[model samples]
Target: MDLELKGKVAIVTGASQGIGKAAALRLAAEGARVVIAARGRELLDRVAQEIRAAGGSVAAVPADVSRAEDCARLVAEAVKAFGRLDILVNNAGTSATGAFESVTDELWQADFELKLFAAIRLARLALPHMNRQGGGRIVNITNIGAKQPRAKSMPTTVTRAAGLAFTKALSKEFAPQQILVNSICIGSVRAGQHEAKAAKAGVALEQYYANLAKDIPLGRVGRAEEVANAIAFLASGAASFITGSSINLDGGASAVL
Candidate 1:
């Protein structure tokens, strides 16, 4: 049960809410010094407070990972606060799904910047620090759509597919140095976006979730904490040998896996 995370330092992006928030809390619970990042300053601060209330060491850095400078700044801020970086969770992204024709050039550019480029830049920045420490973990938060692409799921699926490839390539290049890389392929987890969509449709939240579960074999949508459990495990010392792999956290919803 010991994740062996005490005294480690981790940076989690898109960490203001949902899966990101859950991952931050889980890492802090395991006694890791956590740096939480998101575009929303208020929500980011709240998460930091919750971690502190739980007696966890944490720093909140509000950054839009889609921007190159922000990604660099996030890394610098974390190292400045903690003196070293041991884990990097590239979780800052939104699910932008739609018909190919309906997807604008602007949307494509934005998706690549947020989901793909950000991860690239952060890993590039975090690698040297990990090298100094001798080893580290980079847990990319991708999703099942990366492997099981469906109709009308253009940019999101495409972006995530790149993430899977990135995870493998990075892991292979860094394994000799003991810098393990992996990804958590998420499923239909209950998130802030789903809550907003349910409210907009005037459907009760539970009913909305019930409708979503109709197609899932597990008969329920996944919780953020469920995904966080895997994130924490992958980032911990216990997962020392795991690299260049993607764990599907879909509860039997993903057919390809």
Candidate 2:
């Protein structure tokens, strides 16, 4: 099916690896001119080169989204490179899981800065461009823990809850302008953190993933590409009517409806 994404311009944060990198590749494959952002210069450039090698139009911008100035610069560079921005995928974040008492003020502040505030700042910066262009899409990559928090999940859950609220609020405020805003609440997707855990456990990578699947109803962890597919759809014309909604990309692991 045609996503109607050809010639569209997209900016995907955390694009150096994992779900962000996967989403960037998918958008470019669907014919969007993609601007990939991450703090790691070499890895970000490598992703861009891979996209270009596949005959996709892409550029890599190294930026730490946790900084407000970096967020502004990233958006500016994308606009300068593409002339217009059609999609903003706010996928830059790290998991900050801990017990409530273990999560100090510093951890909470840092988590909010990177996950919640970064999305807020980027959306604020990009909304005018979308408004001027008549419409756009914003996809926030959150986690199911936002809706179904566990006992020990502290800073991450709190911040992701804020992200969920942000997505809904933006969707309502911008829908009249045809600017759709949505979020994908991911579960146990294969990412760098999971890979590192597997290595540290001295377990085979595949076995570690299999162990993770034991708790999931689907009996498997999600792939980065699978999450990317969801993000691409949300950013495409096919999802024109979808807004203010948070879809769980988990493998039925989340108990909440």
Candidate 3:
């Protein structure tokens, strides 16, 4: 059960809440020094403080991943705090729901910049550091919509597809250097967004979740921690040979390859 991650350093984006927060905590639990980056300074600081209270080494760096300078800053800040970077989790993206005709140019640009371009900038910045360390791991938190596109998701579908492509191509490029790059395509998970939507609908949380679960084959949406576990495994030495692959973490919601 030893992830062999002690003394390792990791950078997790969108780490203020949900999956990113869960991943950050999980990595720290496994004995890795963690740097949590996100747009919300307060939330990021809270997560860092919580981890520290749990006897984990952590630092909070608030940065909007959409900006290239911010992405570079995120990497720089993590390295400054941890001395080295061993893992990069690109998890700072939002789900966009809109039809092709309804999607605005601004929305498309925003999605691409936030999800695809952000990953590109961070990965580019982290490459040299990982190469210097002789090896590292990169995990991109894409969505199942990337593979199972729907009419309602225009920009998210397209941009996540690009992220998947980035994951695969970069994985191949970094494998020779012993760095493993992979993507995790998440499906419906119990997140703050869902909770907010449920509250707005004036429905009991359990009823709301049950209604949402009707569409999933597992009869329920996944927990953020569930996805974090998979990410931890992939980032750890346990998945040393895994790269250039997209692992779907949907509860049979996505039937595509």
Candidate 4:
């Protein structure tokens, strides 16, 4: 299906790798001018080069989304590069889980900063631009833990829950403006963090991923490209009527949904 994304301008956060990278590539492939942001300058440039090499319009800006200024700068740079912003993919975050008592205030703050505040700041900055254009899309990347909170999943779940609420409320408030908002409730997908964890545990990467897939009803983990395809749809004109909803990308692993 044609997403009708050609000539659109998009900003994707944490876009140096994983789902973010996939989203960037997919959007660029659909003929959107993509501005990719991440804290790692080297990786960010590499992604930009990959996009450019494929003849996709792109710009890379190294940014740490946890900082308010960085979030502001990312949006600004995107607009400056592309002349407008039509889609904002809030995908910059990390998983932080621990026993309730073992979790520190610092850790909580850090998680909120990286996950919650980053999305909040980016949305706040991007909404005005969307409103002026009369419509836009905001696709937030969250995990299934947000809906089915498990024991020992502290700060991450809490913030994701907030993200769901934020998506719903923002969608309602912006529906009139055609600025749709939604989220992807992702389960385990192949990613760098998982690879690192497997290496740290002295387990073969394939075995580690197999263990994760066992719990999923599909008997396999998801792929970053799958998530990105959904994100690209959500950010496209084809998804004009989809708003204030969360799609489960968990391969039937999430029981709450």
Candidate 5:
């Protein structure tokens, strides 16, 4: 499983921690030069240094994805550093859980700005560069809530649903140019914010994760690396024929297709 990714370049957003960090390390492990982006400069730089310490090629670019300028700068910096971009993983996002009536217009708009608009802007910027190169890959990290639609998850569910639609639409648009676009819907994963939440709950970390994992048929939440593995496949030549598809990596938490 060479992944045939040697020398290929990838841009991973939200790469400071959580699944984004996992994806960045995995891509670098597979021999792809990686550009890690996030708003936290120190955290992003630390992750980049970890990759380099493992003998992987990586550069850190601190930028907020919600801004159009940052999105363009991210891609531009990747190209400038690596010469070409082969993959884009839109993983930066924010979560808001509230009833439909409780969620304000500002809340919805802010969530969209972080999750949906960022992906849209990055895809738009990457399209011409990918088209010029003849082909590329884009993997959007959405959520299972997009398909399931929980009542308390009004904002996240609505925005993630739109993100799925965006992935599908981009897939069709990029197909002719050989740029494959796909998405991965995440389930519960023990990382970053989740760990912080667990700590705040005053619960034993292992027990908290175990309790959370009990809901899935697989009897556990997914690992960040597991989701990253799927992203790697979608980004690789092995998935050349795959586009406009949504894959779930939720340890059987998502019952829907």
Candidate 6:
């Protein structure tokens, strides 16, 4: 079924690779004019080129979302390029994991800056435009750890929990304006980070991924495209009634309800 997203404009952060790249491609494929953002120019350009090659409308913008100025610039550039912003996907973040004692205040601050504050800043910038347009969608790519924290999960878990709260609060505040907000809580997905970890462990990428899936109920890790599909759905008219909800795209890996 069509998502009825044609002509809509979307800004996807951290679109250089992983779930962000997949979400950008999915949005473009659904006929949304997409502005893809990341800190790396080369990979961002490559993703944009790939989308263009597939006849998808996409533009690459390099920005570090942790910076307030960069967040404002990203939204401005998207409006300048596409004339309006209908979707904002806050997917740019780092997985800073460590024991509580090992995580420094700097690490905690950095995690909140990128994962929480970026989304907060972008939403603050985009909400008025969305209100003016009569409606819009914001999808925050958080993780299942936000809902179910394990041992040794520091800054990431704390910051992601904040993100979950942010998602809910925004959903409530904007519903009156028809601005829907939600989150996709992720689990283990096959992405660039996993590849790096595999290489670091001196194991084949496939083996590393297999090890990751052993504990998941599905017997395998999820694909980036799988997460992207959920992102697109939340940003589409198809999810008109889905505000204030956190959908766990973890293939049943999350133990909490």
Question: Per-residue CA lDDT of candidate 2, range 1-257, in tens?
Answer: 89999999999999999999999999999999999999999999999999999999997899999999999999999999999999999999887898788988999999999999999999999999999999999999999999999999988998999999999999999999999999999999999988888898899999999998999999999999999999999999999899999999999999987
Q: Which stretches of candidate 1 lie over 4 Å from their true place?
A: none
TM-score of each: 0.98, 0.98, 0.97, 0.99, 0.97, 0.98
User: Model 6: how large is the Cα RMSD against the reference?
Assistant: 0.7
lDDT of each: 0.95, 0.95, 0.92, 0.94, 0.91, 0.94
**Candidate 1 vs 5: which has more TM-score:** 1
Residue-by-residue lDDT tens digits, candidate 6, 15-69: 9999999999999999999999999999999999999999999878999999999
RMSD (Å) of each candidate, 1 decimal? 0.8, 0.9, 1.1, 0.7, 1.1, 0.7
How far residue 101's Cα lies from its native spot in candidate 2, in Å, is 1.2
Q: Where is model 4 poorest over a 10-residue stretch in terms of lDDT?
A: 90-99
- Against the true structure, candidate 1 reaches a TM-score of 0.98
> How many residue pairs in model 2 have overlapping backbones?
0
What TM-score would candidate 6 get against the native?
A: 0.98
| Poorly placed runs, candidate 6 (over 4 Å) | none
